[model samples]
Target: MACTQVLLLICLWLSVSDAFTYLRVHNKSEVTVQDHWFTQRLDHFNGADNRVWEQRYFMNDSFAQSDGPVFLMIGGEGAANPGWMTQGTWITYAEKMGALCLLLEHRFYGKSHPTKDMCVANLRYLSSQQALADLAHFQTVMTEKLGLGNRKWVVFGGSYPGCLAAWYRIKYPHLAHAAVASSAPVKAVLNFSEYMDVVQASLSRNHSDCPRMVKLASDTLIELLDYKENYIKITKDLYLCEFLVIRSEMDISFLLDTIAEYIADVVQYNNDNREFEGVKGGNITIQVVCDIMSNESIGSPYDRYTNVIQTIMKSKGEKCIEASYQQFVKDMRDISWESSASAGGRQWMYQTCTEFGYFQSSDSISQPFSGFPLSYHVQQCSDIYGEDFNFPVVTAAIQQTNENYGGLNVQSSRIIFPNGLIDPWHILGINASLSSDLVALPMQDAAHCADMYPARPEEPPVLSSVRRRILELLTEWLQL
Candidate 1:
C-alpha cells in the first residue's frame, strides 16, 4: 500500500490491478466487444517527438444510435480488458441510452506499452499529464474517424482512473460533456496517513473492539521485534517464507506494513463482490475480520492477528508470507515487463514518487496500525529509482499536483463524483456537491468503486438508487 513492494504483493494475493483499486473485469457480457488500435504519440507535449505507439482500445457499438452519446470508460493502472465493454454499470447505461461504448487502455499498462521496457529512462513519459493528453488525442481521433460530430461524450473511471475522469472534465471540459468519477481521489498528499484512519474507522464501525484487538496485536508484534531472539518465533508463527532478519528498520517495517495491508485489503474491498476476469471477489467484510480478532478461543491478540494473515494467505493459495526487504527491492529493481513486479506495480510507484504521493503510512497515532512510517515509503522511491526521488522531491510533486488540479476544490461541471463512505481513499475525494451540475453522491455502507459494478440481487438498495441517479444525471446532461 505504501510502496511497490507492498503493492506487488497485494496484486499477487488479491489478483487485482494496483492502478485501479478493486476494478474488476467480468468475463461474461450480453454485448459483443472488439479491440482496436490507434497511433498515439509517445510525448504529446513535445513538438519534435514524432514517435508513436499503437494504443489499444475496445469498442462496443451494439447499442449505438446515430445521434447518441459516447460512453468512454478510461482504463487505469491495469490492462484494458474487453469484458468492461460488455459488463459494468456503464454498459447498462450505454444499452439504455444507445451510446457507443469505448474502453481505452492506459498507456504503458496492459498491452499499450509506449516504450520498449519499463526502464527508468522510458518511464519519463508515464505521467498523469501525458495520460490526460492521450485521452484528449484519442477523443479527437475517435470523433473524426467515427464521424461523431458534436455528439456528447461521457467518461467513466474508478479509483486512479476516476481521478483522471474528474480531471479530464476539468482539463478538457469541451471534449467530455459529462463524467462519472467513482471513488476518485482528487486530492494528492505526501503522507496519506488518513487512509489507515479510515480503515480503523471502518473496522471500529463494524465493532468497537476490532481496533483495540488490532492495536494490541501490533503492540505485541513490535515488542517481539524489539528482541532479536524472537525472530524465529515470529517468522514461524506468521508462516513467513524465510527467517526474520532485521538488517535495517525497513526490514522490520516491510513485515509490519504487509500485515497491515491484509486488513487494508479487506477494508478497501469489503462486501464489493464484483467478479474480476472470471474470479468472484471474496465477501470478506470488516465484520469477518472482527470476528477473527474478537474470538477468545483463538488464543492471544497476536494469535488472532497471525490467523488473519494466514486465513487471507491460504485463501489466495499463497504458501508463505513474503517479508524480506531484499526480495522486495530485488523485485522492484527489475524493470523488465516479464518480471512479476512489472504488472503496473513499478509504473504506479513511479507515479506516486513523481506525481501523486499516495504513500499510505501508519505514522498517525489515531490509526490502529503502526511500524510503517512516511520515511519507509520515501526510502522505497529512492531505493527503486534513485537519490533524486527523495522526500523533498516527493513532497514538492504532491504540492504541485494539488496546485495544478485544485485538489478537492476541482473546478468542473456536469460531472458526478461518487465515493464510498467506508473506503479509505474517500478521504481524498470530493464528498460534497460543489454545484447544481457538479454533484457528489456519497454512498453509505459501500466500499471502493461499488457503483461501477453491475447491479446484483444482493446489493444494497441505496446502491441501486445511486446508479439510477447517475443515469438520470447523464440523461439530463446529454438531453436524451
Candidate 2:
C-alpha cells in the first residue's frame, strides 16, 4: 500500500500493457504483421471492393499459452462486439479454457454494416454468401497477419450464424481446426414448410384447453381466403378500423401464417398455464388463440382480416365498419388451399413446411409470428406496400439457389447441430444431409433458440447435456 511500492507496480503494469499490444488494423486498408501478431482491414482482399468486413486476430496474450493451439470464437448473427457471446454458461467456460477468442459481425446486421443501402431496394446484398466470404477472408487475414500461419483456429455459432459455422467449414476445410454449430439449420433455406407444419402440430396437440379460440381463428382465416372482399372485410373487422387500398397480389398465404402461429404460441402457453409477456420479453403476439399468441402488430387471423377491411375503407374515404359473413362468402374464389405435398416448389407450403429430411418447399398460407425477422415484414404488409416486405424480398433471394452454400464434399472437423423436436425449425434437420461431418442434436420438447434453456432453468436435462458437450468440445479444441 505504500506510495513507493504502488509506483513501482504502476510502472510494471505499463510495461506489461505495452508488451500486450499485439496488433492493430488501420482504416487505410493495410495488413501490418509483426513478430508475435499482425493487424489488417479485412475488407482489402485481392484489391477487390471490400464487402464490408471486420478485423480478426490471434494473440499469445498474458494468459494464453504462446505455443498452444489458437482458437477463434465466431459468434452468430449481429455479434459486432467481442463481448457479444456473454451468455451460455458453456460459452463462458470455453473462453476460460485459454483460447484467443475472435468475433465477427454478420454484414448488415450489426457493426458490419452492408456497404449497399439496407433498404428493400438493396436487401439482396445481405445474402449468406457475402457472410461466408467475410468469414473466409477474416480467417486468412488473421492467420497470416499475426505470424499464426501454422496455428489452428476454431469456429462457433448458434441460431442463424450456426448455419454459417457448418457451411464455413464445408466451404473452407483448411481455415478451421473444428466447428461447433449450435441449433444450426444448414438445409432449411427456402423450405420452412416443415417448420410451420411442426408449429401447427404443436398447436393442435394443445387444443384441449383452448379448442374454441383455436378453431375460430383457423376457420375465420380459411373462410376469409374464399374471396378478396371477405378477406378484406374480415381483416377490417378484426382491426376495428378502416384503411384505404388492397393488394389482390397479396396471397391468402399471409393469413394462413397468422392463424397457425397465433394458435401455436397462445394455445400452448395457456395449456401450460405459463404467462406470455409482450414486447417486454421482446415478443409480440399477432393473434389471441385463447389469449396465447403473442401480440403481433397485425393481430390474429380473425383480427387480421378485420384490419384489412378497415384499411381498404379508410383509403377509399368510406366509413364502413361491419362486414357480413354472407357477403364475404359471395366473393370467394375457387383457389384450392395451397398444399405442402410437393417436395420443392415456391408455394408457401413448400417454403415453410417441414422438409422432414428433404429440401422441399412449403406452399402453405401461414406465416411466422416473430416480427424481428420474417414475421416483421409479413405483418407490415397489411398496412404498407413496399420492398420491405419479407415475402417478396425472400421470394427473389430464394430463387437464386445458393449452391455454393452446401457445395463442399469434405468432412467437417467437429460440429454439433441441435434442434427441438417440437420446435418448428427442427424440421429443417430432417432435410439436412448428415454425414460423418455433421452431428444432429434434437431436443424432444423445446422450441426455437431452446439451447438458451437448461442454462436458463426453463429447459430439460438433454438441453443441459448439449451445453456441457459444447464446453467440453470447446475446451478440447482450444487446448489442441
Q: What is candidate 2's CA lDDT for residue 425?
A: 53
Worst 10 residues of 2 by lDDT: 1-10
lDDT of 1 at 472: 94
Regions more than 4 Å wrong, model 1: 1-30, 278-281
**CA lDDT scores, all candidates in order:** 0.85, 0.44
Consecutive 10-residue window with the lowest summed lDDT within model 1: 5-14
- The TM-score leader among the candidates is 1
**Per-candidate TM-score against the hidden true structure:** 0.92, 0.58
The TM-score, computed over Cα atoms with residue i paired to residue i, of candidate 2 is: 0.58
Q: Estimate, for each residue in 54-102, the C-alpha lDDT of model 1 and write its tens digit.
A: 7888877777789899999999997887878777889889878989888
Most lDDT-accurate candidate: 1
Give the Å error, residue 396, model 1: 1.0
> Could you tell me the lDDT of residue 70 within candidate 2?
55
